[model samples]
Target: MVRRMTMELAVDVARAAVQSCRDAGYQASAVVVDRVGIVQAVMRDTLANRFTLQAAEDKANAVILSGVDSSEFRLNRQDIRPEINQIEGVLMMDGGVAIRAAGSIIGAVGVSGAPGGDKDEICARAGVDEVQDRLDFAD
Candidate 1:
């Protein structure tokens, strides 16, 4: 059976992600989604770009659906799997990460509005790591 992260947990993760991005001096939008690609939480920094929300959501969906970081999709362009991108809200680009705990994906996090994709990914990973302890405890 797939164990899902609670809504409260999702909020905590999203908050942590947003905080990390702010600390890094980048205004960003953070999105959290469950394993099945359903949105859980979306938080945007006060100074984030207006488009960050959608971009973050798309990245999160992409990771949740594809079971990998969105950047991986960009890196392996020739191996692109079109079917994964066909998902309604998926964005097959960058700044997203699949949350894996105990060898299973529990959710995904996406960050956007950074100066570069790499920066966005760093913020996203920070958020994921913030919640890593919780995931480990659950295991």
Candidate 2:
């Protein structure tokens, strides 16, 4: 029943996410948060905008709160309760994705500072993919 994201994994995820953005020819920031929305790791590229840090954190937090990818929420934003928008650390953006371990959400990764939200999301997914092996579920 125990579920948690290790510090090593968190750092690895964050770093890989940032690297993905870099390889895509963008400088960005990436944040990794445990299931409770508590930040576990953060990384900002050398030239990333200062706001990218908060953007990344908010994106990840939004996923944790909604239990859905932030991109999914972004697509259905019009149907979302207005009160949800008022919550702190919630951003209906496309850059956050849930991190599943053993078929359960263990954490999330969010990337920002890309030219577009979709680009940020792409980098975030790359980060998760990098660690997928460690999170494989036993059938």
Candidate 3:
């Protein structure tokens, strides 16, 4: 049985990610996706660029497809990064963090619209940290 994170959790993560980015003085957006790369929730901060939403989703897809953080995948797989990015919905960029529970990656959180991918990744991690307690006890 494939145990996926709930939509409620997905929404919470997305909200926290966007808020974290806002607190960091960046108008950003966040997208959460299930393990299979299906979007579970999305949230965008006001004044954020319209394309940020798609960017966030693509980062999350990168994580889901790689079973690792998007940034890590990109860093470790630069040889194939360009080719991978050619695929639809695959963005080998930063700002994607794996959402793990029950000893496995249950989903991922992606953030974008910050000045840099590193900044986006920091906000994405903050979102996952916001739900650390729940993830630790997840089934």
For each candidate in turn, the TM-score is 0.89, 0.94, 0.97
* Residues 30-74, model 2: lDDT tens digits: 999999999999999999999999999999998998888998887
What TM-score does candidate 1 get on C-alpha atoms? 0.89
- Per residue, candidate 3 scores C-alpha lDDT tens digits across 1-139 of 6887998899999999999999989999999999888999999999999999999999999998999999999999999998999999989999999999977999999999999999999999999999999999976
Question: What C-alpha lDDT do the candidate models reach, one value each?
Answer: 0.84, 0.91, 0.94
Ranking of all predicted structures according to lDDT, beginning with the best and ending with the worst: 3, 2, 1
Worst 10 residues of 1 by lDDT: 76-85
Per-residue C-alpha lDDT of model 1 across residues 1-139, encoded as one tens digit per residue:
6689889878877888888889888899999999887889989999998799988999988787667798996677536557656766777777998787777889999889888878888888888888888888775
User: lDDT: which is higher, 2 or 3?
Assistant: 3
Candidate achieving the largest TM-score: 3
Tell me how candidate 1 scores on lDDT. Answer: 0.84
Q: Regarding TM-score, does 1 or 3 come out ahead?
A: 3
Candidate order by TM-score, decreasing, is 3, 2, 1
CA-only RMSD, every prediction: 2.0, 1.6, 0.8
